[model samples]
Target: MRQQIDGAVVLTAADEDVMEYLPNRGVFMAQLLGRDRGNAFGFYRGTMGPGCEISRELHTETTETIYILAGQALGIVGDREVPLGPGQMMHVETNVHHGLRNTGAGPLEFLVIGHPDF
Candidate 1:
């Protein structure tokens, strides 16, 4: 699963890819790029059902950049809560506690990019 065109790699919805869904977590994620592509950073597309949440946690070695694609989100960084929506983005530094909750009525879709291939 990868596509190479003119020395560039491209992965689209049309590509047959594997997506991981955790019912208990109410999350579905697709790794678009990472070790499988020999990339140093990881790129993923994730979705969470309404009312679902990812508990606060810290990544000691990985920095994460999240970009919302659709729906709304309530992002918790450290002790602060920030509201997010489509086209908005959030950056979480390494070792910082952060989490996200789907605050919209529908599914929350977003992109997550992490360094060091996490």
Candidate 2:
């Protein structure tokens, strides 16, 4: 069943479900909002342990934007590698292969928003 937000919905961390995207890598994600919730886009929060990296991948029809919330990471967009930290943001265009790697000593947390419900 799709969840419908009648008005303003406040999602607390304690109410969210955390999933492991990669086993034994300390990579976890929590889906905060999505089309199933009546949103036109998808919103997620991800955390990566030090030295962990997301395998390179791309969205064929959706564009993704990520905002670093804590710690540091290296964002690989196409052929460039950009260092990002808290308060920094990165955009990955549709069909562009991209990935992120935690480069800090601590956990790397970030918010991911994708258009068209990725």
Candidate 3:
């Protein structure tokens, strides 16, 4: 069934479907369920506060394309670092190490889309 959603509504997917995660480094407060658009892909929404960072990590199982919805972030992908702000998108393949950080002085809203039925 096709339904409409407002930013305020809650959604679920994985068993612990809640999207917000409070990490010691930053705030990940908003999460949106990725409605499958066919294939083995899904989406995840995350909100981070200023200085919030996604620790350096690699993906060996699932690949994802992350898009910045608001604010700005610094991404460390491989041996390079790049800055991305609202409306920017980056594609990351599996097995590559990459992470994101909210370098801006405000909260960052972004989405990370992944694939495969995990």
* lDDT leader: 2
Model 1 ranges off by over 4 Å:
14-18, 21-24
Best candidate according to TM-score: 2
Candidate 1 C-alpha lDDT tens digits along 47-90: 88899887887899899999999999999999999999999999
TM-score of each: 0.87, 0.89, 0.72
Off by over 4 Å in 2: 1-5
For model 3, which pairs clash? 40-116
**Local error of candidate 1 at residue 69 (angstroms):** 0.7
What range of 10 consecutive residues in model 2 has the weakest lDDT sum?
1-10
Clashes of each: 0, 0, 1
Q: Could you report the Cα RMSD, in angstroms, for every candidate shown?
A: 2.2, 2.9, 5.8
Winner on lDDT (1 vs 3): 1
Model 2, span 41-80: residue lDDT tens: 8898888899998878889999999899999999999998
Each prediction's whole-model lDDT (CA): 0.85, 0.87, 0.72
lDDT of 3 by residue, 1-118 (tens): 2334653333353333444454436655333333343355566667788987888777788787889989999988998999999999988898999888899988998878877523
